[model samples]
Target: MARIKLSCERGRSIELDTARTALGCIDFQADFVLPEGRAGALGLPIEVLLAALPAAQRALSAAREAGMFVFFTRECYAPDLSDLNAFRRQYDVAIGSPGPLGRFLVKGERGTEVIADMRPRDGEPVIDKAGFSAFHQTTLDTVLRVRGIDTLLLMGYTTQCCVASTLRQAVDLGYACILLADACAAYDPADHEATVRVMYSEGDNFGWVSDSQRLADASQSIEH
Candidate 1:
């Protein structure tokens, strides 16, 4: 477990009114979460599962009920993963050609679908990204702007990579971002802690960070 060494880490109740929007990203895709999920994927699926699906759902539900402008994003390119950069293509080959994961998430394919239990509602939008950051190629910012969203609540997989990248950019773009420190999972424990420490060190201006339970209660209370 990653213990908090920073004195600034404060626990708070949830308050939804403090922000204009909340965004949740890549919540343990089946291709990346469950074994059965990768049944027909083209590439080998993700490793380093956190086995915390239930908690993630609760956090998501809290965000939704709080009436925040809930949003979601995931990694998937168009057919053949062509929308992905060349580096990802090379990754596909190494993971094994014709693998289920590689074949799935080929954009427009059923395999690329978000995990069933946590699928977004009709009103929610899913941003497709080839690279790590959801803002890299997608019009997420445009949607955020249109929706009058200025803050985001992010959670998901691979804490050190995509999650961290998303956090950094979200801050850079002038949006208030709160990361559910426990709601996310990563490939390595050290990497996870390192990422959190780095983000925390970035200072209070970057955003607030907390555990899923704190955020959940806050959301339930519609508290800030």
Candidate 2:
């Protein structure tokens, strides 16, 4: 078992276990992160997306130094749109044509690729998910099981959507998750705040919330 550390805030705390924990970055792809990317086209706050970048990078560095596993998820849909749900298709129409990004979330498109700064390093796993939840229609569960990752430290785009959805599923699947609140954002600040408040609730109904710096400090104590 990995050594466990506790992070407490506002009368709540989450345990962080080094060996059993992994940093799961959800949907940090160009479509969502870049200022001129798909998210901007949809009128989602590109600033909100960009704001989490530095914190995410810091967390990744800390996890790497601590010998923790890191996984990046990309929201990819089939080129033929077979994999897109009604909401996504509708979103595509709302965002107008995909422009140079190749029709929104279609796989193999530049917009669908992970952003340059957030790219996965050697040995890091990149999981392609077709829906809001990384666990939905993806091999994330299998990967985590095989690697023995009992806990997940989450970060990435659209806090109220993909991030929240994955966090909920992760809890149900019996994995302890800590949402890096400062490392995740949404199109709306209110949405982001509400999601964090729910996760950071007294009883920890879903998981816990912490900023990247706190998580990094906690990971640093593991003595890699």
Report the number of the highest-lDDT candidate.
Answer: 2
Off by more than 4 A, model 1: 1-8, 11-19, 37-50, 90-96, 101-104
In model 2, what is the error at residue 60, expressed in angstroms? 0.8
Off by over 4 Å in 2: 1-6, 41-43, 86-97
* Steric clashes per prediction: 19, 0
lDDT of 1 by residue, 73-136 (tens): 7777666545767776776653223445445555654455677867888888888887778789
Model number with the top TM-score: 2
- Lowest summed lDDT across 10 adjacent residues in model 2 is found at 91-100
Q: How close is every model to the real structure, measured as TM-score? A: 0.80, 0.91
Q: State the lDDT of candidate 2 residue by residue for 75-124, as single tens digits.
A: 88777777777886776563324655766777888888889888899989
